[model samples]
Target: MATTKSSSYHHGDLRHAVLTAALEVIATEGPGALSLRDLARRAGVSHAAPAHHFKDRTGLLTAIAAEGFDLLADALADAPDLRERGVRYVRFGVEHPAHFQVMFLPDLLRGDDAALLAARARAGGELRAGVTGMPEGGRGDDARLAGIAAWSLAHGFATLLLSENLREPVGERDPEEIFRALAELLF
Candidate 1:
């Protein structure tokens, strides 16, 4: 574990550390437990230090959500196919349990910030564009719907898994197979 004293307060990465610590708080204690002061303390910075990077709690959360979307976009981009993107999203949610929890639970974070909204839109656009580029259909509403459907399915599956709602034996089948099965059953 990296000691707080070893971390540079004046370094360019302090903001990132604060955000990362805030995420840890959110994951372990729920978003309600997250606070600028607490994050600063955890990062071994003064209480007022977070204020230098984030105007308030909202700013901090907005940054976290933006970071989440950027990561999601990258994960989606790396997938080889539409189905693979869905699998990748599920994988990302599982791997980034903290970000995934806060990103979807809008009640846990500030969802009203303009910057956050723009970042979310950019991520959404990236997902939609990836789907639109697929050979399955032409770009536009159809492709957008495909993107939405894919995202919804993956998100729902991930949420269910996190909540332990899907107790069925989902072994060896892989996420793609499960996704296809769900799509066939629902849509």
Candidate 2:
């Protein structure tokens, strides 16, 4: 493995490679199984290679969470309406289950990492935009409350679907459609 990837340690995109490997591991084994040494093995680099980018496990988790929030912000921005935001939110969770698993767990992240904070704030702003679009409500407290409600619905439904708790009840129907229907009814 070292012979095959000797050049990678010196020339390849080491940070991205390790991050992808870490995400793959998380997808299969959950975050508890994540280790810099394991990630290095998966990426075919020396065990210390990951540390150059992430410093430690907490740093790696923080980077993953930061990336997740950025992706979420992009997804929410692409959505056409508040209902669609909820739909896309669920879709994002389903599509990026590894990121979904680690993104919101504050205890698993550095919490105050600048990139994480900025990415989280960006995602938060996108979610708030959905509520701000509500014509009936004024700004400030009304918008804040509505944003909370909207986020609660999307996040709760996404969490349920990820846990497969909704599979039996939701059956084979598209979860995005189900979430759209639920959002329509509740909102």
Candidate 1 wrong stretches, greater than 4 Å? 1-3, 107-115, 134-141, 171-177, 180-187
Model 2 error, position 135 (Å): 1.3
Q: Residue-pair clashes per candidate, as listed?
A: 0, 0
Best by TM-score: 2
TM-scores of all candidate predictions against the true structure:
0.80, 0.92
> After superposing candidate 2, which stretches have Cα over 4 Å from the reference?
1-10, 137-141
Question: What local distance difference test score does each model get?
Answer: 0.74, 0.86
RMSD of candidate 2 to the true fold?
A: 2.5
Tens-digit lDDT track of model 1 for 29-99: 87778788878778888899889988888777777887888788888775565666777778888788778
Worst 10 residues of 1 by lDDT: 1-10
Give lDDT for model 2: 0.86
lDDT score for residue 71 of model 1: 87
| Pairs of residues at least 3 apart in sequence or in different chains that clash in candidate 1 | none
Tens digits of per-residue lDDT for model 2, 1-187:
2222554566777887788888888988999999999888877877887899999999999999999999999999957778998888989999999999999889999988999999999998898788877676433557777778889899999999988899899998888888888888877
Which residue pairs in model 2 clash with each other?
none
